[model samples]
Target: MGFLSSLLGIIGFGIGLPIGLLVGFFFFVYSKPKQVQDPVVRPLEECDTTVLPDLLPEIPIWVKDPDYERAICREIRRQAEPILAEYSEKYKIKAIEFENLDLGTLPPTINGIRVYETNEKELVMEPVIKWAGNPNIILVLKLLSLQITLQLVDLQVFFAPRMTLKPLVPTFPCFANILVSLMERPHVDFGMKVLGGDIMSIPGLYQFIQVVRAFKLMKADFLGLSDPYVKLNLTGESLPGKKTTIKKKTLNPEWNENFKFVVREHQSQALQIQVFDWDKVGGDDRLGMQLVPLKLVTPHETKEFNLDLLKHTNISVHNDKKYRGTIVLELTYAPFREDSTSALSAKFDQMDSIIYRSSSNETLSKAGLLSVLVEAAEDLEGERHNNPYALILFRGEQKKTKLLRKTRNPLWNEEFQFALEEPPLLDKIRIEVLSKRTGIRFRSKESLGHVEINLDDVVRNGRINQKYHLINSKNGQLHVEIEWTMV
Candidate 1:
């Protein structure tokens, strides 16, 4: 009876445990929600939406929301600022604004960039770049200015590559990358220049942040951008609006600038040039050019770059064909910017005129009607293009006379009598001797047929029975000889 009672108790306990666990599980499954310690959803009444994102330092360049370039600049500043501030203590320089620089028909020179009118003066730019970032980041930044010419160019910057410009400005330590811009009118060429070196290199990240703080304090770009865009002085009169011209007497950079720059075109304008024998050779550096600067005489009264004649001389001819040096002035001025077209360069009145000259070497081919095929380069005679182009030049004193093209004429046996309209200053006569299949022999002491010449009083003829100097009669050759003046 005791064993049966123990067994009954165990069975009853097992049955109660399973039932209790099942009931508790069902109750827990349908229980109340568990509360979060901190609520993430903010109440609408307490939300603050007064400050705008553009006001943030990360979006400094975006003055307007839609401009893509502004957005890109902002992003660049945001990303590069941290890495730049590592080494420098002072601020990084922002962008520089160049506006209303002139491109008056004439080309400038290397030195002319110094002043507005003449390469005699130099070009100096004050930039304007507005941004909000750590002033320290300015250390890695550069503000470069390049001076250019037809042959070569140089660069100047806020700072050197590896070194700072503290000596130039004792209080400030800055560096820049001088970028030389070789401009072909509306287009700018970057491959023409050479970059100096890299900026400051810092070791730690926290130190770089301090450098950015310093850059925020320097607002140098404001100095460059404050000036207005200069307008073209058409009508020879200053427009009724703002006076853009800086007086020639004042001789200073007033309110005029441009960003894309090549070398100056006016540097050679002031030079006093004399075209002798188809070559222009100036006396000295100072007397080499003759230049006139552009300026506003009065607000209402305008002035065209009227170059009637500073000084000149003419020739009196009595024949149908005329030949003389026609002294013409060279006009050099600036264009407003890239793609800028002012009616300044219109027709013959706007183009430069050079006195016509003929030389001994430049024998223009008698082809291409209206325009002859010249050897040496001709200046901008007709309507000139705004862009730069290639020029083919030749050496030796050559005449701008008519000549035949060297064609493969093997049976040129008859004496090619070249009748010059004028007596040629002949130094050498070139003959194209050739054969179809048989090549001309180099040099043998056997004469076949020869040449005859007569220069005014001098004369010579072919030999009869003498040992013939049988030149490239076997193969082909171009025989040329110096003109002998019989003394």
Candidate 2:
């Protein structure tokens, strides 16, 4: 009797479970809410325009800010089609075109614009852009044997960018260049659908989108529509300034060039940058110029500048009206070592004591090393064969460089050292360029050019790198670097 009752109970439970499940499914499918309202629809022509004012309170905070401005969505959509088509072609697609492209009526908003007030001739503004747009952009792509449709929906982007309009002038469209850079990583969110199925809805795909969307903003800077080169030098020095290679026939050129200069007094010295448009026939035109004071930079640290190009160093009301573009560069100042600085200080103190004790008419002498580096000679023409060499003559001591055979421009890069008991303040060094022929000619040797350089400036400035014109030769120049270091 007990076994039969248990079997009957199990059979009744199995039958009731299915019946209950079917009843619940039926109610769930047929159930209706207690409250139901139909969505209101209106025709586009009959829509009331005055209702926009009532909806102002529901707008975003960026829309209410006075500094915020709406982005031109229509123009952006128009310009993006060709760029997208080009990108599709790059991927070897047979045909790709935008069937529907609209950024929608709700444009991207600038949260706020912060303008900086600086003494320099640049206008800097930082704008925060926040966009949560309902865009309908669809692209139709045709591969070799297949066609696909892609749709973009529910897009959002947020970023802060620094915009700079440099060298403000009085003319129309006052700024010469516009530079844009991202301040931080951008945030982008969107939904992408392919063939009526959302591909972005796949698991673990959003993380990849995050990485792909992180990118930098491109700068809108412009250069002169000519060949451009840069000359960099330190002020108060007669050095042959360092030069960058010329870029040909390009309005926008990039020269990631580096240079170093010997700084005597960082407090008073300044860096001068001169940009010129290269011309093969005549003199190069002056594109722009700027001066950066060394005192503004901290030693041992690198600093960057986007300096606005100017007519000259002397800033005036009239010159401010000229727009000469801009230059971007990095500068670093490295001072002498601690031991060298202490040794230099002791030498200066000893010189001061000697000046106080000695008579004013007596000559003061200090032991130092004089280094003369003959780099090269340019445009050297000898009356005979042009196998050129350089001769350096100091206080009755002469040093000569290796003779290079048959070259108008010879690079010797030779260094000569002279241990001197006194600075060559009142003295002069004579450098002569002479050529010797290998075979017997009318004259075996001939003088190309010679120059006599005074040593007063080198003694005062510690170093001088300059190209001096030859005294007797036409269109000849000698490159020399002289350094006076305390022993």
Q: Can you write out model 2's per-residue Cα lDDT over 126-161, one digit (the tens) per residue?
A: 886879987777777777776666777667776778
> What is candidate 1's lDDT per residue for 312-381, written digit by digit as tens?
2222423223222122222222221111012221211221221111121222211100111111111111
**In candidate 1, which residue ranges exceed 4 Å CA deviation?**
1-13, 28-487
**TM-scores, each model vs. reference:** 0.15, 0.30
The 0-to-1 C-alpha lDDT of every candidate, in the order given, reads 0.24, 0.67
| CA shift of 181, model 1, Å | 22
Indicate the TM-score of model 1. 0.15
